[model samples]
Target: MNTLYRKSLPGTKLDYFDTRAAIEDLQPGSYAKLPYTSRVLAEQLVRRCDPETLTDSLKQLIEFKRELDFPWYPARVVCHDILGQTALVDLAGLRDAIAEQGGDPSKVNPVVPTQLIVDHSLAVEAAGFDPDAFEKNRAIEDRRNDDRFHFIEWCKTAFDNVDVIPAGNGIMHQINLEKMSPVIQARDGVAYPDTCVGTDSHTPHVDALGVVAIGVGGLEAETVMLGLPSMMRLPDIIGVKLIGKRQPGITATDIVLAITEFLRNQKVVSAYLEFFGEGAKNLTIGDRATISNMTPEFGASAGMFYIDEQTIDYLKLTGREPEQVALVEQYAKLTGLWADDLENVEYERVLEFDLSTVVRNMAGPSNPHRRLPTSALNERGIAGDDMLAAAKAEEADGLMPDGAVIIAAITSCTNTSNPRNVVAAGLIAKKANELGLGRKPWVKTSFAPGSKVAKLYLEEAGLLSEMEQLGFGIVGYACTTCNGMSGALDPVIQQEIIDRDL
Candidate 1:
């Protein structure tokens, strides 16, 4: 049943084979157990395999055959500022190399459409306790990233098929979810599914919409942009069965923190996770997005929830035009991609989690998946009796001390995408202000939301000022304080940590 296919791509002769049949042929009863992701990859191989050696190649995925190699052509490339800047710097250097070798510098361009947004550069130098922390922090951002931004501007006009969204706009993944990706793309009177590889590990945030977005290293993104296929064997797909509903007052961030811990404990690294069950259907696109945005945190490749009503609803709510939204519904339903149609889908493995068990939580001193439940912080030593007393003593002396929560940053697309989490932080800030509580000076608080629209909603709710009062200001909407570019700590605080090695 192996079939051979040929395609004439620019600068390359492409071939595809019947990977499922190839695998089945190599070993009996193999394809049926393949994960949903593998099934899609097998189809990709079948469509792209060459007539000369198709069968031998497809045996890799189907029969657990890992001998031969296959090339996967993702449809697009996405990037954020940190890695994207470094990537473009590399490309610019590569252009230098090509020019040295007499290759046209102009000819070296991204073959696929590449979207690079300015994120990951801002740091919360001022806490929400400041009346204008956002503006102050933004000023600091401009000072720190002057070099990065200058080069990025050069990249815009110098490269073809590349679009840059400048700094202070929003985080990359949120922008993609909101405006960048059109679920079905139309060009030359033909329509195709939108699939992409991003430079950040959290690119799968858009996977909730069924776009097949994945996070790859900058090297992989560059390869894809150059029209080179990312070669790989299909990944293991794991099904996560969700049950029960989250309790009231629990944010999606809390739920995802718990799920991250559970899935990590289950050892679901590098696997494609497909969440199912009634509970998943009840969760809004926002909630699903929060979980999907944390794919890398759980050590998974892609966290996908099948395209369902929530997907369509979110598309409409985000102001997508009627026709495009209709197209998403039509294409998904017709292509057997609709959620209801996937009931019989099989997976290599399955794990179950209950939503009700999730409590208020925050992740990490370092890692995103290290869930620290608020209730157990004392037991865990993050909020011990001694630590509380130390903080109090520091406050009484009009100084910041141990366990200062140095950065209560409301940043990153991970938590900011969910209105509940964003609003919850604002509510907390508002309550703190009313009660005369304020963020410690050492705590550089910031509210770096991932979208301009987020500001609109927060303003509409009248919570923006409350956040600012606590020194949590609108700090140039970007991935600030996350990704370890926390900017320079306070001079005295830096000396203190250095002195104590704490």
Candidate 2:
């Protein structure tokens, strides 16, 4: 409240609150021992807390105490269509109630910046085998969601500080990673870290860029949207030290699936995990994002990485301005938010994971955390069965056979947001085409990247045609299969499941 420590950024007109100075003033030299999370939280308190209560709140974080509650006001709020629409509907209803009580209905609006993306309504109604699948699926989405679209359109004009990205654009998480977050924000002459709370569980995907992003339910998001602080006790901050490099032929997806299993087994529920060490530093921002995107699957509140060179490279790759990128690097180093500065920081619990131990894996059967090593598929009796003869017989009898794959989609921001994963799928499709291999008759294969930029890169690499030829063409660019919007199965396949109780 005594104007908490302000300093002008070097070579810029912008100024930022010196969170470290304030902390050091309270308890000399304490800033050096604070973890990255604690430092970020401390900045918000210094900027927003009341004068009388500020010391008490900062003490809780500084002493690593979890016995008391504190308040967090995120910098922004993001939403996908499903929950975003519902929250807007609630706001509209609240306005009606206020008007009935003789208050101004027109005065109701969001207090913070809210970005609503229409990504959840589209389903993959048409399979990728159809050349017009993208167009057809988008048409179906508009037809079915006409009323919702109308409401969303109204909210665009009726609200303040709101931005809407229409359907068929991209998934919210991926967009946030590519463009929405600045990593370092300069507003009203002050620079601060970019932090947000989104309506979807995968919102932490952008945390890879060193932003403090977390997913909240609609009600909780509403509270934040109305400018109320999200009260919380200090979370268990777990340090996951990644040692050794990943073995060759291993994708980020493989490592994340393995990490998901490990973290779930360790019972990391409701904790904030900081991934660091040699292996973590070696990973690309795309790889870190893949892991952060699965925070919900691993039962962690946030999967954070320290702001470092990888963060700088990603901002440039995503086409951020040079000045902004320079500002991010300068600000991080000056404030001890950089990874190198966190080397001696201590955590309540530390877990070491050897990355070289990871192998190609898939999570399934029922849970995302149930990792199954691809090498052990035959050993575990999940493959190598003699179903070929039975499948041939069923096909000859004009039935969609047993063990048929109803959907084989490369959907979701989970994998598609990472270029390496998308390129890997494209390469596989290309190799399959060269070998004259094709998808089975009953399998519905589709490639739905989280952003159009993926298409640009794939085409530049000349892998788009091969993917399309293999029945993995682009579909609508929204969350398709992951949101239970996989669309209708073929009539025969549907009947078979119905008749057999599958």
Candidate 3:
């Protein structure tokens, strides 16, 4: 509590708060058994907590006692356009209220670094089949949300410590994973873990890089933005031991869907999960990110992986500076936050999952946690009994029949952030084109990847043209369908559903 230990990085002028020193001081040799989350939380408290109360707070984390509350000051905040805009609007209102109270309105501003990406406002009105779908959809978005865009543009200049990524750039989560987050941040001669709270639940996507990011509501995020600690008790930490390798041709989506079903059945709601073991070690950062992005769907507060080689590789692949990447590795290894160092870390409860048990699958009509194997679609009453007859009837009637897919989109950060998943989709499209198969006329299909880099890889693989030939052309980079922005259905199709009470 009194002058927590600090040490300089070897061969560098920067320094970091020695979390291990603080832990050992509280209880000798206690740092070795602390979980990765606890260690990071402890460092933050030691650096930010009041000197008088710091010892008690460190005790709560060290002893794993949840009876008392502790304060957590996240390093940053991330958001999408919808909630970020609303939060700023509220702040604007607060400024006015301060003026009415004879206070300086201009003094109100965000206390932490805030990044807002304009991703949730666009819709997929122009289907991939259209020749100018991307341009048409973007035009429609601008026409419809001109006033909103104006306000957002104003917010960039009006706000302090806020950065805006304009529309048509990419989804917030993907951008954060690929560009924004520095695994180890150095500021004011001090290095610390990069932790944040975002407006969207999938913010945990960056947890794959070993950064502690959690999704919070606008109000809670506003509290953090105003430089207030998020009071909390230690959560029930559960260790998920992933064993065995996934079968060939299996995607991260399949594995996550299976894990979601298993975890939900195990009553893992509101728990913090740390995934480790051989299976986790084999997974690429992209694969881990796909699983982390689905954290909220599995009803868990966080799904974390310890910092390791994969984390360093991803940082390099994403074009991070060499010095920063080195800092991440050095800091993690020195503080025992690396994956190899966590083998002896203890947890209150543990769950084991086998990756080989997962298969090709998709989630159902409503729940993301419900798993449905592709081979059992007919047996499960999802596929129609007579496909040929239905097609023939629709052809004769000169109209698309009921049960025709109105939207088939690949838009969310969940699968798009993983190159393997995106590449597989491209490969499937190529094979389908070669086999003389095309999308159904009534199906409005689009491929809105979360990052521009995805498009680069797909093109380099010589699969983009194949995908486009099959009516899976690139749409806007912003999120579609997942946020209820799937755009308008054809009037005839809308009428048909209405008439049939579907």
Candidate 4:
């Protein structure tokens, strides 16, 4: 351990590595300009890396040098069933190979904490049109996954340092955001920033809490579980300066979709982004999470926000213990990871975006980054007034349009974690219901939020039934429309399509 920089954390008994002291000693005044990413990484290096190579690794961040490989030991590893199962199965294969060579197969166990959540692959066989969709869907999931689930159960007992969360719990990313990340971690009487790696790209969702989290491939996650440090050169640490406030009634989803397109155009492929400025300050942690969760869409490794009052507020709101929350704030401020501490930080590339300039936006028919204004269908000659008139008239006359909206889904996991979007949706649904609007017979509709808490609040607000009245019922979790799994089309619609060949 590099005890040279170890110091007492004033408010807590746990000791912390003084990253600022070490950095300033190396290069005077350089510590003040380190970005949030650098500060967290440098802390890890100071606390965990071999003392012999610590100075060189610290130089990788202090000088913005990307030539040499430094080691990154993420504090935790998270996974979803799809990739989690695959990684575990690979371990089993390795164990077999090791046993063949007369190696101790039992000794080959994960050293780092691993949490596997079975969520992503849950197929929505039962559409939300049915009142009992959640139960029916889970029943189908259990029956079909009977064998795979048996293995998952076995994995729970067989694997060391691994926790298996069965299906129907919630989305892995959401669970991580509200529960898994601590923002600050304490080990062996030493406190440092929490860092994590998840097999899924949306892993950055927890970055809203100021944790240094990155998404890795399945193999990378497996390697991490085996306690292998991620070998890395520094990525382009880009800064996104958010300015202006979001217009009234503009949801975080709207802002994120716009930001996703903007970041994609900036060619920030594999960059680590830090969002800050007045606009970012105005955003709630929920808003930051929405943007960070879409890291994959922007083709970035992470979308980070610094620890600030917002991060503290979110921690408390999500039910984190008071002591832990205090530790996060104190640690962040002390180690220069706090938002206020980053005013002088510099980035290789900086992008400026205006929150007010963005219109309420949505993505394309295929891509999340292919942003479009909600009103663009007419301008783009895709859906004109004539088409709308014809569709309404046809519906009234009991005739089906050749092209129809077959699937309607609230699939991006709002209402569970994001109250603003879901509340707006529920209000809209209530208005539509009051207007006697109903789901089209040909459409299979579903509402899948990441957490069940969404149901409680929506019910309390009398919006759940309002949405359900329009066929936007609580179907199940993990019904993401972006993933090509928004439940099956109605059987009648399928038959009609087959018969008409349209």
Q: Which candidate leads in lDDT?
A: 2
Error of 4 at 371 (Å): 1.5
Report the error of model 4 at residue 125, Å. Answer: 1.6
Greater lDDT among 3 and 4 belongs to 3
Ranking 1 against 2 by lDDT, winner: 2
How would the candidate models be sorted by lDDT, starting from the highest? 2, 3, 4, 1
Per-residue alpha-carbon lDDT of candidate 2 for residues 384-420, written as tens digits (9 for 90 to 100)? 6566667778789987776677799998898999999
lDDT tens digits by residue: candidate 4, 224-305: 8888889999889999999999898788988988998899999999999999999999888888889899888899999999
TM of each candidate vs. truth: 0.86, 0.96, 0.96, 0.96
Each prediction's whole-model lDDT (CA): 0.78, 0.89, 0.89, 0.86
How does candidate 4 score on lDDT?
0.86
lDDT value, residue 384 of candidate 2:
68
The RMSD (Cα, Å) of candidate 2 is: 1.6
TM-score of 1: 0.86
Model 3 ranges with Cα > 4 A deviation: 99-104, 384-388, 396-399, 500-502
Model 1 is weakest, by summed lDDT over 10 consecutive residues, at 6-15
- Alpha-carbon RMSD to native, per candidate: 4.9, 1.6, 1.7, 1.8
| Number of backbone collisions per candidate | 18, 0, 0, 0
Q: Write the per-residue lDDT of candidate 3 for residues 208-253, one digit (tens) a residue.
A: 8889899999999999999898998888878999999999999999
List the pairs of residues colliding in candidate 2: none
Candidate 1: segments with Cα more than 4 A from true spot: 1-35, 51-67, 89-104, 380-394, 397-401, 492-502
